[model samples]
Target chain A: MPKASAKKSAKPVEELSYEEALTELEGLVASLEDEQNPLEDSMRLFERGQALVAHCSALLESAQLKVQKLSGESLIPFEEESE
Target chain B: MQPTLFSSIHLTVSQLTLHIRKQLENDPTLQDVWVEGEISNLSRPASGHVYFTLKDKNASLRCMMWKPDAARLRVNLQDGMAIEAHGRITVYEPQGTYQLAVNLIQPKGEGALYQEFLRLKAMLESEGLFAPERKRPIHQLPNKIGIVTSQTGAALRDMLNTLRRRLPLAQVILAPSPVQGVEAPPALVKGIQLLNYQLPDVIIIARGGGSIEDLWAFNDERVVRAVAESKAPVICGVGHETDFTLCDFAADLRAPTPTAAAELATPITILDLSSDLLSARTRLTSLTLNLLAEQKAVISSFISRLKYISPERRIQSAYQHLDELSRRAFSALTHGIQIQISNVNGISKRLLSLNPEGILSRGYAIITRKDDHMVVSKVSQAFGKMKVRVSDGEFEVNRGLDTAAVIE
Candidate 1:
């Protein structure tokens, strides 16, 4: 269900995965180049594209790997299990 | 001597051998047994029966295994190989010797474990569990990754470090399980099943390198089946580069070590993604600018042609043409009048030369008869009164007297 919702652009740029953000950005560029979209529509597409680029760059800039354990219903930070 | 030892029982050689065979075969411990020893003097003749001597530091026993049992052996039998053999003790009456009848044989230590590994590998392969089509391609960019490994083991730390260095954006879910010992096989199965519920893009089952006995859990049939059945593709990294397990065969992919598994999971690094993003950003700007340039060109061309044929421009040019024509006509009229004046002056001068008044002015006199207004050139032609005209006055005269004087 989460992945299904993620496919739509309604999700915020920060929440979108790298693949998702890049995919939507590329789509916007193609539409702008190939179609005679209205000026207002083109402006909207361009702004969204810029935001996606920023989000992707930020993700790459400040990322840290996190490992977690699947508890009953939540994920907790992974710790060493006692032998 | 027989009479002296009459109290003891005397037995024939064949009878003694048969009695000994019965005693050994009838014993429950010797009826079915397992013995461990080093092989020596191993031989296989034309009869297809294998004969060998099983020995240790203290004693040695002759052993025989039929062709059927030897054919089922997974490892090659050689002299000096320490092996565990299962059969019963039997005595050959003719040779009068007791030997082990080996129905099953396996090399001891790691060799025994390897034999079982081969057996399971063969079985799984025959069932198509290790088929090429069964293998799935790992996700290029996995957002969520599931790992089944020992939380306390070095393998877990190595894998985590590798994942962090390559792709820090990925979220890893650890399913802790023991990687060795008798309890490890079921625990690994549970770990794989638990991760399956989360629906990760990939699952990595990993453990550090170890001896064959220490890594035998990965060769467990239950674990191998679990790996084969995982919904997400599994990458088995159980042992060293040279070590292999049945789970490795069943997995979608295999890596030599836990760190290698982490690397395999993240085929694309953060650097690669960053460059891709940069290019996409560049394309977005360039494409939009190009579209604007194309539209500007169209608009400018439209403006140029629109200006070319406007009515305002046409009327202004027409007014300029009218002014030019009127100026040329006025100059032409003035030139024609001047030419006419010169012609009139020349005609008037010529007319003055022919005028009689002009001759009289030169002091020439003219005489004419008044009645006919004719001039007389000979005296005989003058008969009536004549008129003489001068520049300022005129007088009348008689023509007969003049004519006679002229004739004299």
Candidate 2:
């Protein structure tokens, strides 16, 4: 059911890492492949899958690893090692 | 009676000490006894023999551990360290003092702790907390990965570098807590809760290589329960490859080292998922195109093969056949008319000989009255003036007698 995807909207697909995006994209691909599926839902999943593929590829091509630490409630940049 | 006074009455101090030493050495109970006391005045000389005073609050005994026996000491002995020494009690010959000739030494309270560790392990193990079925499989690829370890510890550095090199796309959140000491247990539990609330796909609780006491925090009940309660799969890497703790049992996966935890957390790297995504995309694209081509071919064949033979072509063919037939008909009629024309011209010569116009052209005469304007068939029909008519010329003669003269 597309309702399964309701939680995915909270975290933007673009913010997801390559693995996250790729996992979601794979699910979407499987859903889209079902010919008997509703066209409207299929189209939405197709669009998201396309975006995920692009996002995953872009992240793979980029060369940076981001690290953050939880402070109070928010994430702060952790750079303790550089000092 | 002769040797009586010196021999029978008393002996020298050396003989008395020698008899006492032999008596103590012959006693099975005093041969080897375990003496537990605080060590005081410990002395390890160049000869490598260890000499120490084993004392309780009441009294003290001189203890001597031989060089080879002291070399077997697993636990270091200091002046204040409480120890349990095992050896025989024998009197030294010159000083004639009875002391413990120590052969083995161990820490006083460590065995009890080890027993407690074993007891707890057995208790928890019976409850199925350490059952293999309870362990969740590690997520194949984790996006949000939480790390619980000391911030300044080398384990944290190692995990960070490993994650960076292997899979940069994984987002890491550090939950820093003391990984050692008495305070580490509750702190580590809190760290686990915090990461669990962060909704990470997976978590790694790890520490570098450590002694049993240093890593005892991992065996803490609270830490083990926290690991067991996690919704996300957890990887426990508490010590070196040879070391394992109760946390390793409660964890979903046990990694031998912190770097191994990192490796297990990031099962698929960016490069790996990238290639997989590309492959999926290629398959989807090809599949779509194939279906489209299939439909297009059906449509094309239907339109070309089936609809092609419909009325339009039929009318064109009909028109072509009609034109050909009409052209043949017109040519055949013209040919028949030309043949008839030649046949009539050949027959016309015979009919021409019988005609009077041809005979008159040779020579012929006829007379007619002028008033009637008709050719005279007989001379009697001539009026007062008769005209003679011939093929080439006409003459007038008087009455009927002029026929013959008119001709001359």
In order of appearance, the predictions have TM-scores of: 0.63, 0.62
C-alpha local distance difference test of each model: 0.87, 0.81
Instruction: Give the Å error, residue B169, model 2.
Output: 2.5
lDDT of 2 by residue, B104-151 (tens): 776786566667788878988898988999988777777789999999
Q: Between which residue pairs do clashes occur in model 1?
A: none
The runs of at least 3 residues in candidate 2 whose Cα sits more than 4 Å from the true structure, single-residue gaps closed, are A1-24, A36-51, A72-74, B1-112, B348-408
- Model 1 chain B: weakest 10-residue lDDT segment is B1-10
| DockQ scores of the candidates | 0.55, 0.39
lDDT of 1 by residue, B255-276 (tens): 9988999999999999899888
